[model samples]
Target: MFWGDLHVHTAYSLDAYGFGTLRTPAEAYRFAKGDAVGSPAGDVQLDRPLDFMAVTDHAEWLDLMYTCTDPRMSAHPYCVKLRNQSTQETGGTVFRDFVNPTITQAQPAKADVCTDDPSACDDALLSQWERMQQQTNAANDPCTFTALNGFEWSATPNYSHTHRNIIFAGDNVTPTPVDYIRFPEIDQLYSQLEAGCRAEDGCDAITIAHNMNMGDGKSFDVETESERTLALRTRYERLVEITQEKGTSECLPDYTHRESLGECGYETYITSHSRQKPLADFEEEEWERMRSSYARGLLRRGLLTYANRQDAEGNPLQVGFIGSTDSHTGLGGYVEEDQWQGTVFGIGNFERNMSRMGFNPGGLVAVWAEQNTREGIFSALKNRETYATSGPRIALRFDAAKVGEVPACKAGGALAPIAGGTPMGSTLPEASKAAVFRIAVTGDKAPLEKIEIIKGTLKGESYEESVIPVWQSDKGEANACVIWSDTEFEPAAPTYWYARVTEVPTPRWSSYICQEAGRCEEFPDADVKIQEHAWASPIWHLPTR
Candidate 1:
């Protein structure tokens, strides 16, 4: 399977400055092609190249970094006069605020192209946008690389958290992103984009929600914090990023206090590198303290829905998960050995240092697709046939049926059962009084080991559950299958089930190489004793009456 890091930032993003590498659109594409870290001008290369990369720099002050750099643009007498500092430092002043400046500061200072005229903004901005698009298209060589046009929409509702990354599939067409839409609310942005796409042809876009842990307890809510019923959320947001370079979005210890130990403490949210009151600060161990609360919240919201009646549409708001590295550096440096080369902090530069550059080589995105092409990859993401990793591409397959049931599907052959079976993230209908879950575990060709199935239930008003060791396949085959039955399931138990496939302990990238071996020595603090391979089944909930 081919690998792709869907979320990334470029120099166009204000905060990306001095974070080791500051790459332009063209430079970002080259960095991906070489599978390397650092800007086009820097020295490090990635251990493994990504098949595809999306330069999703922020859209708030899109391309401000480049515009401010051109003397012809920034040195306009009007622009120079408005600045308290020297004209050369205007860019830093505009972007370096403790909190990003609002849109009022976005207009040109003069009256003409060279004199701070609003039209000048168009000249510099439009050229930069085209440059970004051209570079993305230039890097698309199907056999080796795919470059996607994407940008992050910063939507902090009343300064709370509600950010999303918007990505596009085809480079053939694009909208002349308007200035009035600058920093609009998330719902409005979604409406604008959806309307724009329908006006054109073959334009497909998807938004991935991120940094939600910082949403102050409202990121995953069914309704907007303002009590607005955002019907478009169900239509626009197709997936949730559950893991990233800074932390994992899986259940936190405190959120899942009842079943908090095993997979709870893996990692937390990505605090920005700046020490000046991190843009979004919270206690380091907050994940532990908030785990149970979060899970309870999820259950509370989920249970409110009735058995048959749905939302405005016949469909329910499906809460599915996927993972990605919110890497400021263009590469998603997920592997420990390659972490130093793939992330921003890994760049050997002292002057560009920031506290948030506290590097942790964590997380990757995995999808179950028919092939490694653009269409196939996009389909997996849209259908939620994807899983995130703390960084190993472990293969996991799961199916549920009655105790005596066996699928006719197999991985090989023209009409093999694999083609007819449901993979992880799929629901199994009730076949009998009890459901017998079957799973197949395969290590990332690294090691074979054990598997876990995390189950939850609502006993009336309270929810109870357990992570059962359903499958314990040996380290014998390249892959192994396990069958287990839970005849004890009560007919009245309000239940939901999911699987976690894991690999046997294996050598981490650090274990195989040391500093003297011309590689970074210590595995990142973010690196944990990972079992290489893991699979998470979709939370199969029976239904709420």
Candidate 2:
């Protein structure tokens, strides 16, 4: 298996650049390859080199700030504003008054910037796209390190985060990125990508949604959409980011109570944001809406939607899970708590350090592939043969089959016969005997806590769920495996099973910050210690009629 981080930003992004990032795409790739890079906090480097990485800068104003900063382009009015207001106070105002309005509303800048010609704007964007592709090509090595070309489509409608990172399989990418400035709606972005990349020969792309916790319940909305819309979504968007620098979107604290699970909350940044104050104090309907903004909730919803709508190939829609660092400082795969760096560029002083404290070191993506090349890694992602981790390099595998047959080791494998079952991310076949699920885990940084097999089954219009603790380490073993059989299995019901591996408690990122300032008592409920964990993609068992 090869470990990688697919979502990251460099100085090309206007927000990262305006905040303080000075690293380029080349610098980001170098940092991912284990080279030390300069940060505002200090020198930053990954503890280990990643097999692959992608620098997905925001597509809204790709390289616009860098272009405007050039002396030759100072004739433009926007360039003049960027040159005049370089301070943090004035920069924030500039972002609110000028940048935010232009991108969010899809409004063009003053005619002076474009000089009354629309193609001039397109030319500037195309130039930046070419430059980005060139840098990515220069850093890509076939077997040593893979650098995939990608960009982020920043579609934050009404201040709600509905963002996606677009990753291409190879160096062959679209000539221009489809940003929200042109495609205001998420479906429109998918349509443009289908025309530009997916339909073209030898070019393919996938969109991974991230930061759903901040979406205010609109991130996973599929209630009243048509069959065609669902088909299009399932075709391009196959994975959702389960964890990131923003927060873990796996499950919510309140929703876990409804599901009869233990405390599953950790590093929740959504509730801490000022914009989410209304959501944090939700009354009735709004509180219920919170359930739709998490990974587990979306999986349940996807099962319902797939049962109703079939794709073009006549297969049910399934979504896999992955994690990324979402680092804005051009440091990919830098997850060490002690050697942490700030996400925003200009926030490093004592007072500004509080802004950085809320963010964790971030997560990593693990793909079961044969080689470290782009083809091998991209295939693993497209097939849903992947897992996620909250910084630790924990190895996990889940498989299911008949009681007497040998279980397959890979995820997303289809069931062959009634006697042999499927793997995770796949549908199970009809069987007479009970299905046996095998789970194996190997921990590196900490000892094992407990392994849970969470099962969600749908009956009629409602759903029933349970978290079965199948295995626990009595001796705190680093490696363990369990084979669990559902003796009360109902072959007529539709069910999904996924595994969650937890580690022994360790100091969280906030704990380190408080220890340095000698103010551990100030933040009493700040969750100083946490148990790092990993979640594998789910395997489904549909009713065989």
Candidate 3:
């Protein structure tokens, strides 16, 4: 399996550039290849080289930044305002003025910047896009590393984040990346991709939806939509980012306490759209809306709603899972807990007691591909044969087979699919009475604690979920495998099951920072040690098909 990061940003994103990241697209790829790249803080590098990466800068800011940063336009008043007032070191009055009301609020381009020439604005955006494409292609090494083409389409309305990262399979990409400036709603972005990428042969792309925890219920709003719309959405969005710098979108404890007890209460920061208040302080309806903002919650809600929405492809709700760092520092796969730098460290001076309290070191994506080439990695992603890890490069394989079938072990200790069975992120054939699931995990450095099989069943628009502990290490076993049978499985129900592997308690990134700074007592509740874990994509059983 090859480890990689598909979501990252460079200085081309004006927001990141304005904040402090100076690393260019080439520098970002260099950093991911285990090279030391200069950060605003200092020289930063990942301990290990990533096999594949995609530098997804913000698409909305490409033109405005290109227009302002052009040497020819150096003396223009608009460019001067961008350089002088917007950058954090200078004053940041203009950056705040630009980002909030215009970008996150999802408004039109600033009139002063775009001016009267709409064609010129389009030209500038296309120029930046082409430059990014060229740089990505140049950095790609089918012999050494795979650099995929991608960009972020950020849509944050009313402080809610409903964003998507567009990743192309190969050189055949859209002439222009669809951005929120033109496609305000998420549906428009998908339609544009259909028209741009899929219109031409040999061109294919998929968008990874992320930060559903902060999406304020708009990230996966499939309710009241048509069947064809669901099919289209399922076709375009094959993966969901399960964990990231913001927090775990897998599940939160607060929702678990009241609803599904999925044991998902770890690193759950930034829970609300309005403020940094806890879920207890939120209104009942607003708190209820949070069910749509988590991965597990999305699965549960999918069971409730997507019963009849299965397309010719499969259920619209079944999505592959992956993780990545939304790091603006242009540092890909920099997810080590020991070598820590805050996400928005302008000069490495992160006030941990303040905004940094909610953030972590981010995560990585692991794909089981045939080779280390772009075609290989993108094929793995499209096939939904991928898993996500929280910093550690834990190896995992989850598979399901009929009760009488036997699971095999591959050469690399990975679990091989049974003769007539399905693997993770796949749909199973109709079962007889029960199904046996084989789960294999190999922890990195840390010892294993437990492996849980979270199962959810749909019965006429209402669902029930349970967490079944399949295996737990008594000794300090960092590696183990188990074939657990669901004796109580119901053949009539449409269900989904996935594996969650937890490690022994270890210090969080905040705890490491506090230990180094000798400020453990300063942030009492926030700096507690955490159990880092990995999540495999779900295997589903759609009975109606």
Candidate 4:
């Protein structure tokens, strides 16, 4: 398996530039290639070179920053104002007043810069996009380091985080990125992608939804838009980012009946950019936020949707899980806690301090692929053969099949008795007697704590889940493996199973911050430590016909 980070931002993104990252796409690719790069905090480099990386800067302001700074654009008055405001030391003033409003209100800036004849601005945007593609082409080294041409569709409607990173398969990409300004709704974005990329012969793209935790209740809404059918959604959106700098989108303790599961609350930050109320303080209406925003809840919804009606087009509502750094400082796969850098740069020490306290080192996406090239990695992602890790380079595999069939299982591969059985991101075949699930995990930095098989089934109209401890280690073993059979498996109800492997307790980013600030004893809340973990994509068992 090869590890890579699919979502990262560079200075071309207005917010990233305002926050202090001055690195271009070339510089970001250079940094991911194991070269030293300078950030606002200091010079930084990845501990190791990533197999693949994508510089997915925000599409909203794809070339706005460069347009403002270019002296040749002095004829545009608003460009001068933007350039001047960006240099202000007020810390995110430009973003707060100008950019954030555009996203939150779904109102594009109609200033003279591009309001009347948008062609000039569109030309500049195309130029920037070409530059980014050129950088990617220059940086890509087949079988060594892969540079993916991608961009973030910043669709923060009403300040609700409905963001997605659009990654293309190869160099044959759209001339320009599809931004949320022109395509505000997620469905519209998908339609644009299909029309632009999928319609092409060799070009294709996949949209991975991220930061669903801050989506109010709209991120995983089962209600289809006028244009977005279930088939279209399943066809385009193949993966969901379960963990990132914002927090883990896996599950919340308060949201589920399985509150006893100790690991459900790892690095949860739903209250960060939202109403700022803690999960314990959530009101009755507020509780619905977690239900729609979490990955587990979304998976349950997927099962319920699939059970109600099988996709006529054969595109089921299964979405795999992956983790990304979501690092705005142009750092990809830089998730080491001790070597952490703030996400934004121009912010004062106060914001930087808060970043260190609240933010994590970020997460990584692992792909079971044949090589390190773009084709190899993109194919693995397309097939949903992927796993997510909370910083550590943990290795994990989950598979299930009948007792007699060969154990030809891999994450996201399907196995059905009628068809064989199902792997992660697939619907399982009907079982006669029982089904055997095999799970294996190997830790990187810390020893293994335990391995759990999390099963979620739709009970009536609601969802019921259980975290079954398949394997445990008392002595902190470096590896844990298990093969268990569900003899009491019910073929009447649809079910899904995924493995969660946890490492021994280690100091969190918050703990390191507190210790360095000399307040480890005083601030108990800041001294939080956690067991880093990885989550395998789920394998599903459809109801036996």
Candidate 5:
């Protein structure tokens, strides 16, 4: 099993400065090492060392927001406007509100800066960005610690659209990172990378979309500008961060009442901070507006719907799942209570220090790979044989096949199939004699409770769902190997499969800290807050053959 964090920020990111302490790439790596044990901002640290880590900071302007605005990088239209906006009394507040929850009202206000000459931006920022990319690649160390070349493209349409983080598997690539500032729209950016990769040898990349819930529901909109046809969910966008520091982007408590209680009540990504309003009071309905949009996106177009839509080519597109901490702090794998590093300094802190804190401990990206190495881990991630936890090195594997399933440990014959064959995101050509589903979930000494497969399928034009609780380590509440076998299938169901693992109880970081510190009131709600240990695979959607 390999452990890492795919979503991380460094001083190179434009927004990391106002919140974090670490600035340089080497400093970020050291910070991760220190934060792996703990930090002052809050609970952050990994119980174990990571096999790999990707320092994925925002690509737009690359670190120019903090640097170009230095007045040293030369005065450009965007930089000048950014400097002006940064100085505004309401600037930070407005920017923070647009983090994950609400639409950014700031862009429209800044529209005037780029209105006259958009190409003016092209000439001004390119050199500084190239230098930053040079620095990022120079910091890569596959021998000492695995470094993933990656960047976050801040592409949000109306505060709601697919916001993706692109990561490369190897160090040798060409050109530099291209974020929203350069290309603005995702489709255009996608076209650019695809063209570049096809033209070059040994050039490959993957994009992971995160915080879809915050995107006013447009993140998963299957359609392009023309609503007549569904957009293409590319194989390039293989993974989605279902959970993050902003809050779990998996499911909402209110909307997903019947399925499972989601982490919805937590502080939202967007608030009216820029408008002189405190971050304390939250409007539930306003939050629901965003959540409702997300649910609607899922319903109107099934998970990864854009992927398989009929195109000129008969090949289908596929998408997968992973979780990450959008921690502005440079530290990665920080999720322990005693060691939590604020996701956003002063903002992520649940306990008020001076003001609102955006800091949540850094998170980890988990993969079940053959070995703990760069190529091994990268291969696992690209193949979608991976899962993510807020922070923990949990090993989980799920498989669906023609014959009934068997454990990798108990299957006895060979574990080679687990490697050669696709486990999670890859699909079977057609339904077989008997569909065997197998899941092996292990926690970091945390007692296992349940493991189940949540499945959704398309029936004709309408979609239907089913939950198969195939394994439960606790039978009537005792430790046992909880496993199940299902041979029956609704012949016509266009099925997709993924697995989830739960702890015996819950392990909310805040609750654990309060117990050790003997401070309950200092916390919010304990009973409602239990740290869950789980992993989800990419949905292997088997559309009707």
Candidate 6:
């Protein structure tokens, strides 16, 4: 299996640049290639090189950032104001100019800079887009490192995050990004992608939704989606980001019945840009927000929606899970807790030094690929053969099959799906009443304590969710393999199951930084312990039609 980070930003992203990020796409790709890069503290390098990555800079202000940095046009008065005191030391005046337009507007348009010369905006955007492609292609090495490129369509209307990364399969890509300003809605984005990326044109792409925990109960807005849009969502979006610097999108403790020990409430972060109140502040809408803002809830909702209706498509929200650093400074796959730095250079640095500790070293995406080439990695991603980890190189494999139909795990020493059985992110046998699931894992730098089988089985209109312990050990086992049977499984119910493997409790990224700063007591909320874990894509058993 190959490990990579698919969501990282360079200075080209407007907010990242406003936060005084200096690393560019080239530097980000080289950093993933195992080169040391300059940072605020000093030179920083990854402990290990990544097999693949995508530089997903925000598409909103590429033209403006490019205009401000260009030697020719940068002398303009508007560009001058944008560059003045843009770093964290000064103020967020210009930053506010760029960000407010995004979250405040129902359909965010170009900033004040766009009004000056709209054509120039297009020219600069194309220039920066080509620059990203060239720089990424320059660093791509087949069978060693795959440098995929993409742009983040940052939609933050009403302080809610509906962000999606538009990553290309190969060098052939759209001439320009379909951003929020021109094409604001998800339907518009999908239509443009389908129109742009045609098989005959040597183009292919996929969109991965991130920060659904920040989606404010509307990320996978199934309540109002049409059948066509749901189909489009299934076609365009295959994977969702399970964890990142901001926090984990797996579940919230109160939102999920399976999570009771507060383990579900891990690493929740609210960015400084949001004006919305905390999750606890909203009384009536809080439960709805919790339900829609999590992966487990969204998956269950998708299953139930399909189970009840024939008008909608077949489980349109059936998707895989992956993790990425979401690093704004080009530090792709730099997820080590001990060597942690902030994702956004200025804010993370300022917050860490002050011991505020909201952000964290994010997670990683591991792929089961045939080779290290772009084709292999992209194929694995398209097939949903991936797992996500919270900053560890933990290895995990999950597969489900009927009583005696499961194949051996010795297929090249790894598990593979066979007839009457399915791997993670797939549907099980059509008529099987129950199945046996295999959970295999190996920890890194820590030992496994528990392996949880989180399940949601349809019980009437809603689902009965539970987090059952499949295996446990107190002696800190480094490896685990368990075969668990779903004896209560019903063939008629719409059900989904996934594995959550947790290591023994360890110091969080904040704990390490706060302890070193000697302000652990002063920053009591920041200093805490957490169980770093991995989430496998779910195996589904939808109601038989």
Best by TM-score: 3
TM-score of each: 0.75, 0.90, 0.93, 0.90, 0.77, 0.93
lDDT of 6 at 23: 81
Better of 4 and 6 by TM-score: 6
What ranking of all candidate models by lDDT puts the best one first? Answer: 3, 6, 4, 2, 5, 1
Task: Please give me the total number of clashing residue pairs in predicted model 2.
Answer: 0
> Rank order by TM-score, top first?
3, 6, 4, 2, 5, 1
lDDT of 5 by residue, 1-545 (tens): 66677888865565664343335555565555444323344444455555567777666644344344432543656555444444223346535632322223214222344457655455445554555456556655554456677777777655555578888767654365666655766566666677665535777788787776566555444444332212334546667776677655554444335233343333234422222223234356544555533322343244334234544121223455676777666666666644552345443344552133332453567776776656777788888877767565556666654344454444212223343334766675454544455565555556667776666666666655555676565532222233345454554555566676666655455555455557666555541344455556644545444
Off by over 4 Å in 2: 70-75, 83-91, 108-112, 253-262, 271-274, 278-280, 310-317, 345-347, 406-423, 430-433, 519-527
lDDT comparing candidate 3 with the true structure: 0.78
Q: Give one digit per residue, the lDDT tens place, for model 2 in 387-416.
A: 888889888777676657765432223312
lDDT of each: 0.53, 0.73, 0.78, 0.74, 0.54, 0.78
lDDT of 3 at 413: 76
- State each model's C-alpha RMSD to the native: 6.0, 4.0, 2.5, 3.8, 5.7, 2.8
Could you give candidate 3's per-residue lDDT for residues 404-520 as a string of tens digits? 776764423755556677778887776556778888887898898999999989766667888899888766577878888888777888888999999988877767766777777
State the displacement of the C-alpha of residue 101, model 4, in Å, after optimal TM-score superposition. Answer: 1.1
Of models 3 and 4, which has the larger TM-score?
Answer: 3
Per-residue lDDT tens digits for candidate 6, residues 1-545, read 89999999887876777767878898899999999878875788887899999999888777777888642456766677767756756536655675667644743334556676778778889998899899999989999999887888887777778889988889989878878877778888888888888879988888998888777776577667877888788787888999998778887655333224265766766332344345544455565565465788788777777777667767778888999989877788998887885556444463644543566789999988889988888888877888899889988888886556654543124444444567787888777767788887877898989999999888777678899999898887888877788989888888889999998988877678768778778778767788888999988887665
Clashes of each: 17, 0, 0, 9, 30, 0
